[model samples]
Target: MTKIVPKILEDPFGNLTIENVLEDIVLGSSPYQVTNPHPYKPISMPRGCGFHGNQTKILIMMYSGPGNINQRRHVRQTWRELKDPNVRLVFLLGLLEDAQYVLEDESDQYGDIVQEDFCESHGNKSTKMVMGYNWAVTHCPAADVILILDETLHVVSDIVFEYIRDLVTESPTRLFRNDIRPDQHTGNSYVNLISFDVAKQFHILFPYIKPKDENLNDYVRTVANILSIKHIYDPYLDHENPASFFAFTGQNVSKHLLTYPLNINFRRLVGRKVLYNEDIPHQPINENLPPNIHRPTRCKLLRKGAVQDQFLVVVWSDAFDSEQRSTIREAWGYPNITVKIVFVVGFLDNHQNKIDAESTTYGDILQVSAKTNKFHDTLKTVATFTWIAQNCENTKFVLFLDGNINVNTSMTMTLMKELVKSNDRKVFLGQVNNELEPDRNAKSLTYVSENDYPFDRVPPRMLGLNYILSFDLIKTFDISFPFVKYCSAVDIYIGIVASKLMLTLRNDERFDRTSHSSFLRGIP
Candidate 1:
């Protein structure tokens, strides 16, 4: 029979010098038992059976801290749940030098319940090794497995222990619910259960860890190294339970099981209700019909000579800061174009400043405030389209642009030519980019499908940045003006209006110049 030699080192104050005790255990000629005893447990595993009915001894390690009533209650419950008759549960508590005076009295209460260990130093290293040594000497002779437990962590039910027992029986591996990675932003944290083999291996690689060290996420990494243990992270285990075990374990394993739904308790507790209201019917703005007006064949908007010289460009400038207005002015610096820029200033307090008309050579600036009260910003955008119809007569087309947009002069010209070539008189022109591949269509136009309007797509075109619109469509919008009020967002409102009006929107890939790189690369 191999003789078991126990070597103990106790330091309650040191971060974690438990590796020293592990070194002693592995180096010793004989088998060893390890234990830690303190009033408060850090974090640990449940006590249970090993592979092939082998007897496993458990050491409950603790550092001194205020006793938690909840944890104690759970611990008592866990004790009742353990079914294995062969497992021995040993508790080791570390005592300070001052506590030694009354140690005899303290020992009397717990000595019968758990094996008591004492260390002189307050550092964690001394405390950990001393307890480990005590367990080795007292239990190593017959122990085939070792269980470590922290005081704060409690077994919710006996099922937890049985689950771990089954895990060990099936594999000679470490089990944990923690994952740590260099790419991850959050550092080491506890996970439910991990195996000793991996823990021991981790200890070899990271024998001594400082809490403040950037690489030192959790203390368990060191132990996992020393044990040479293969590990499996079970998401269903509840050693850490509601709180994540990965938090302390620093194991970056993907959770396979969906044991619990996220944020259920809070959602149930809040009891918030969502109410649905009936949508009001939209009415046309322009009642008058053109005698010569005819709906184009194939529902296409663009036909030659459809777009005219005089047009209204509705630029949605929710908050026209000086920088944005300046960019708009610089981009639209054409002199010969008969286009007037209509600025829709949403959420307006006062028109304190206006876009400089003299600087904008291509068009004149028209500000239409939504005056939507608390919801003023949204209303102003709606008002912009309406205002364009009521005010801009003889305007053949309407072009919408966002204030921050910078137009590629050549691309804009090319887009205008396409709009002219596809002069259907009822269709809207929009820009398309190759980068937005998901939205692209075979027609080289991007459109979203609508169930109700099988013939007409919802949000007809990918409407953003700059687009040219027919003046007749603007007139049609004038009739629909009163029915629609302030919408939540401007773009969606335009989409809804375009959808209902049956406006044929066309895509002009040439004008697709909006990009993040353009902004990031600087305004060259």
Candidate 2:
């Protein structure tokens, strides 16, 4: 953590002293900002061995929070490419309260943690990234290229300066970047790379833009446009999409390689090829993945907003259903400024390019790497909630919907706020199908034999096409996914799981099964 000292700081964290900032004159700086008014003096910075070196290096700068020590440790341990002197990695961090004690130990052990003085927040990402560039220019001037990475990424490449230099040399002279962001976040900060000269020019020449949803990436975009910094988009060389990703891993794993979690695909692309099939061509599905203490999370959705209170919405989608999703965006009044919509879909082999492109453009789709099928939809839905329960426990409510279901989110929002106010738990709000019978026909996918569920009727539950589950029930519901067998119908299977968990199914008349839009259950 940086020393606590008085300085002209924009974020209101606490009294802190950053690095020796020379001036505070630049304001209303970059093109991203309509009017930048923050001062230019750092209050505090991580005290340690600076980004010092004279040799050429590919500096991979990771945006990290103070409490993300485990993530940093993972980066330190798994990134085997750092063996080369031409490659360096550092975690750019911001300050936190009780988290600083553990961070101090981490900083002491590893000289790579660069903690800036500003308070860590989702809103201050632009300032954080600026801090990274500032450190790169002022301290690590020897970096040949800077890879803007995230703390949660598992990098799979042996990126050397020689390979990067070759990439830079072969590209058009105007191109100064190698953006690998599959999801165009802040324009794609997770897996983006900029040349040393561009980083320096941006640091020295550009003005600091005010913080916004599209902060650092917008700033970089502004700089790129101003400098005519065009990057050659090569799938294998510069940025490989899902095809190369599947090629590299092939059938060696089954944990599901999501375009979201594995955002930075800086893998070793030695003998990569475009994969056409969903599964491996000749290889068998590898089932020997190490057992997990908890259920493995497959959802790669980053719903970054006021998720501290509740999960606003999660839409069930198909990988190839971009057109439907696009319509949903407009129909549901998407690009929701408060809480972004998340599209949940299983992977598709041929449609991956489209999915990736759509993801890059909207950055709203959450790809759960599970295969798609009638029997597997339950798994997909459950896995997404499981992932959410583990990663986002603070979430109060979750609205799960089919892609075609156009919801009146404002109405739902009002109902959800009431639910939150009442602190309702074990809530399953939908058109409960209480007397469903399993398909006794042997030929049907959902055919259930007498021994499977000797019961006369299916348990009470809502149809899978749409439903609303409170946050309290998600973890319990997720527990049934691994053990409960997949049913012929997804909703019925969920009902069975609910019955097993003894969760009361609540029927809301608003959930009209006959209508395409069911969430608006009670309205005339």
Q: Find the candidate with the highest TM-score and give its number.
A: 2
> What lDDT does candidate 2 reach at residue 51?
38
lDDT of 2 by residue, 30-58 (tens): 12222444344443344422334545467
Candidate 2 lDDT (Cα, 0 to 1): 0.56
Off by over 4 Å in 1: 1-308, 318-320, 334-338, 347-363, 372-378, 431-461, 484-486, 514-524
lDDT of each: 0.40, 0.56
C-alpha TM-scores of all predictions: 0.32, 0.39
Clashes (N, CA, C under 3 Å) per candidate: 92, 14
